[model samples]
Target: MGLFSRRRDPESPAEPFQFTVDKVFVVPVRGVVCTGTVTSGTVRVGQAAKITLEDQSRSVTVSRIEAQGKKRSSAAAGEQAGLFLGGLTMADIPTIPGNDGSIKDGDALSGASVVSVF
Candidate 1:
């Protein structure tokens, strides 16, 4: 077995670790906005993209992420788009249940967290 490998003798099962990102998302000012299934968030700053496939749809990587949880904006979609937020993720809000690729225009994401993997 490897150093960090799991062992099984027909005894018990192993549990999984749950990693997530709880924040907001915004499009880059210059580039065209494309909405995808987020594809995957495993990609870091310099990485290509862990996941970026949409359901025959599109998604865009915004110029910057507007931190509303930081901006203190509990308002709807249109309202939360303008001002810049500061300590948005300060509060431990509930994260989105699953990864769905269907965020449409004017979608309400103020309290929605931006979960990522790797």
Candidate 2:
């Protein structure tokens, strides 16, 4: 399948990883912290992923995963957690398409999509 294709292999039972960002916080010690729900599949620390915002997509790594103040090895669909994104910074936050640098909320209007690259 193509990179952006949603088609799946019937023989494979794995669900594609997809996370919808609810809010974004840039921690001083940590990297970009994205709080959201796991839409599908599972994601683990050290896994590569693509953070999609509108027409833009950036490569990043899952540095850490936590839920309810407890660190987790992986998070599955329907679960809510905070994801520490590696290789990204405050400057990487998605801004309004044509506005003067206003950040977009993680809502359906223009939310961010974090999908596993592999």
Candidate 3:
């Protein structure tokens, strides 16, 4: 099946958590923060998740979740929030390709989706 064509089992016990990255920012002391709207299911602080970018994907543990400038234990679909991710840096994000073939541009989280949670 295609990426967007994938669907969840309605009878499943829990809905799969899905989030699309709208923006990524670096905090002075919080490391990398990803801001977006939860598209499906629910996400909790300390939850293990996967971030997929083009042909690459990485495992990430959610350090914290924030909504409306307040700390929250969890967030559900339709909630706009910022998630502090563990072990991710600005360098990990794809950027303009360098002379050494190390840079990759058009690396955005626009259509990225978090379809599941561990």
Ten contiguous residues minimizing lDDT sum, candidate 2: 101-110
Which residue ranges in model 2 land beyond 4 Å of their true spot? 1-15, 94-110
Q: Give per-model TM-scores.
A: 0.19, 0.72, 0.72
Residue-wise C-alpha lDDT for candidate 3, range 1-118, written one tens digit per residue: 8877968655434446888888777777788788889998888777778888678788887898999999997889999988888867777666655788765343366566654564
Ranking by TM-score: 2, 3, 1
Clash list (residue pairs), candidate 3: 95-104, 97-103
Please report, as a residue range, the 10-residue window in candidate 1 with the lowest summed lDDT: 43-52
**Per-residue lDDT for 1-118 in model 2, tens only?**
6789897545433346999888887777887789899999988888899887557788989999999899997889999999999976777664556566575443432257889885
**CA lDDT, every prediction?**
0.26, 0.79, 0.76
lDDT of 3 at 21: 83
* Better candidate number, 2 or 3, judged by lDDT: 2
> What CA RMSD would you report for each candidate?
16.4, 11.5, 12.3
